[model samples]
Target: MQTTRLPHDGPEISVLALGAASLGSVYSEVSQANADATVQTALGLGVSLIDVAPYYGLTKAETALGLALQGVERSRYTLATKVGRYGDKAWDFSRDATLRSLGESLGRLKCGHVDVLQCHDIEHGDLKQLVDEALPALRELKAQGVIRYVGITGYDLAVLEKIAVEQQVDTVMAYCSFTMQDQRLGPVAQRLKSHDIAVFNASPLGMGLLTRKGPPDWHPGHETVHKAAAEAARICAEAGSDISRLAVQWALQKAAEQGIASTVIGSSSAVNMSDNVAALNVPIDAELLARVEAVLAPVRDLGWDVLPGNGGKAGS
Candidate 1:
């Protein structure tokens, strides 16, 4: 239930922000009732930041969240959604498209304006366009009160750092790059922090690669990395803990230590949400953490290619 303040004069948000991709049914179907319960439970547990995107479940997540948030006081939590990348293959970050996306997102989320509006998956688009056209559009919206904070999200640490430093935005959400497996975001995050830009680390579970269930087929990690993750999960299990719990706790605690605003995570199940919050109270087992790291030593930071601009592999 802990919270962190966003740098650069942004609002305070929960250290454990709710990720809505699960409600979007990214890997599995999520019922409306379950989605509602998940959001409610997170709020009940004092989570104040709910981040979603139109691309998630093709707008299903936003709609579900809007319904759940109905009748609830809007000031109880901070909302964030993204622009660009409407589908798996569709991406447009032009000024017109960005504005249109924000309009559609506000409609789906049933909110007047988002506390944070970020450019979604910028690595998939032309970075030059994002800096040249998309960011200015977001800035205009921010000036118009449609977006309180302007930011960008991507997987490439180098490009993200470039944007974060150059754009002079409020925040950046980087996924799967700041996990226990890959602490590559430390330097880049520090640079952003120096610029008063808050850092939001998403997918601390490493896109399911750090869990006992292992990475799904769609996960870009190589087979060897998956095997290493399996061993790491087993190590945690042998210590009478679940990898998911360790993973989330690690990310949350690490972010807090680093002064990062929040670690974004997603789950459609209320039980999982409760369990994750509960894990925050449990102390980090250093020996257990070290053992898990040892198991993942071989493939540490060795993930499949997900970076843009160069089609290069990340966590290398």
Candidate 2:
């Protein structure tokens, strides 16, 4: 496992991180034992960033993670959770809601304070409110020792950059915008680095578009995007490799090179999580990657939010 240091003297964390959305059963139900193993296995593998959310599994994920982390040294990892959005349609970036959300998350996580506190899914929240109320609340918490650092997470790269630079936060996390197929975050991340703000990229698989099984029906990518990914998957398979493996390795390695401090991957199965870590060790086939890149050429730098027919916020 490789590591990268956060900007502004933040703690060094693993380049690859563990996402707990699956443990919360967002896609499907996961047994408690499996969830525990997934978190523990990631830790044993030297994963230092564990990201969860109050909206995930409606709080089940945090509770499960709390139990798994019991007795585990607090210094072993950086814990991150989100505020603002608490459900699919519920969003509150107000000062009161943000404060209440953090309190609930801490109770569920069984931790005195989280290392990083982020404003979740800002694309859906009222931006003026986030800036006027939510961020101030988070920074206040940071000042009071309730959290060490403050950040924001969203799906829009441009907005992320705008807020990161304007608000001057510790970090910014954007998903599905930094994968091999969509490198839109590269330039934005570079600029953010100049501000000494650490960067995090989630869903390097484009939230499933880069997977072999293909994007789910709810995925917002156009049909053309799906076809391109399918061809890339086939090309990798013919080269005796899996697209998921290449996708993970490409995201982690590429992110590290692009000034991203960490990339978060979500999975419920412990075996699957370990396999992802192992995939990083297997050298990425250059020719195979090039071929896959060619296959994905048509949709290079694409994002569902900006794609036609998408709700602009769905499938992220």
Candidate 1 lDDT over residue span 36-55, tens digit each: 99999999999999999988
lDDT of 2: 0.86
Worst 10 residues of 2 by lDDT: 307-316
Task: Show where candidate 2 strays beyond 4 Å.
Answer: 309-316
Query: What would you estimate as the lDDT of candidate 1?
Result: 0.82
Query: CA lDDT of 114 in candidate 1?
Result: 87
- Cα lDDT, all candidates: 0.82, 0.86
Cα misplacement distance, residue 216 of candidate 2 (Å): 2.9
Cα error, residue 86 of model 2, in Å, equals 1.1
The pairs that clash in candidate 2 are: none
